[model samples]
Target: MRLASLSLRYKILDFLYKVYPEAVEELTIIHVFYEYHTVDDIKKHLNYLVDKGYIEQKEICLRLGTKKTTNIYKITSKGIDLMQGIIQDKAIPIPEDE
Candidate 1:
């Protein structure tokens, strides 16, 4: 899929790709804000990535006493390949001077 057309999805995938190795430990509420526009937007974007096979979702228990469930996402190999292709293709536009 075209990265520009899938801008939001790509952003989510990029975040997942960056955090895949330490996803369980590094991801946090604050990180979402630093990386994305909003929580609901990120959620919707991640859902699209999940549907497209770019990301895998897992439910992890964050607390022992209550077994609080948290959603953790990781990028697939296919996602990395796609991201590399997009980067190589250089499909993103450079802004023009106003």
Candidate 2:
């Protein structure tokens, strides 16, 4: 089932949090949400998190015959704080399970 945008963003954050210091490629994130969301949907949420400083984004460029770019995402301290309820945002509706 498709989740609301807010819920999707929350899920993205939670998933990233589970990996902590390890950064995940955009493709991996797409796989996680593919059943419920589109690539564009996942990218939009990822960009939003980067803009809000909740996550850090890195782009790696690879060259073989053509240039290819991959986006890697990792949760920031602010993101961890948000997950821990140390900070709150009206945009992300985090659950109170922690």
TM-score of each: 0.65, 0.89
User: What local lDDT does model 2 show for residue 59?
Assistant: 87
Candidate 2 residue lDDT tens string, 5-60: 89998999999999998999999999999898888989999999999999999988
Instruction: Compose the digit string of candidate 1's lDDT tens values, residues 33-64.
Output: 44535666556666776687767778878888
Error at 61, model 1, angstroms: 0.6
Q: What is the C-alpha local distance difference test score of each model?
A: 0.60, 0.91
- The whole-model C-alpha lDDT of candidate 2 against the native structure comes to 0.91
lDDT of 1: 0.60
Worst 10 residues of 2 by lDDT: 59-68
Q: Residue 46 lDDT in model 1?
A: 69
Best by lDDT: 2
Q: List the residue pairs that clash in candidate 1.
A: none
C-alpha RMSD of candidate 1: 5.7
Cα lDDT for residue 57, candidate 2: 97
Model 2 TM-score relative to the real fold: 0.89
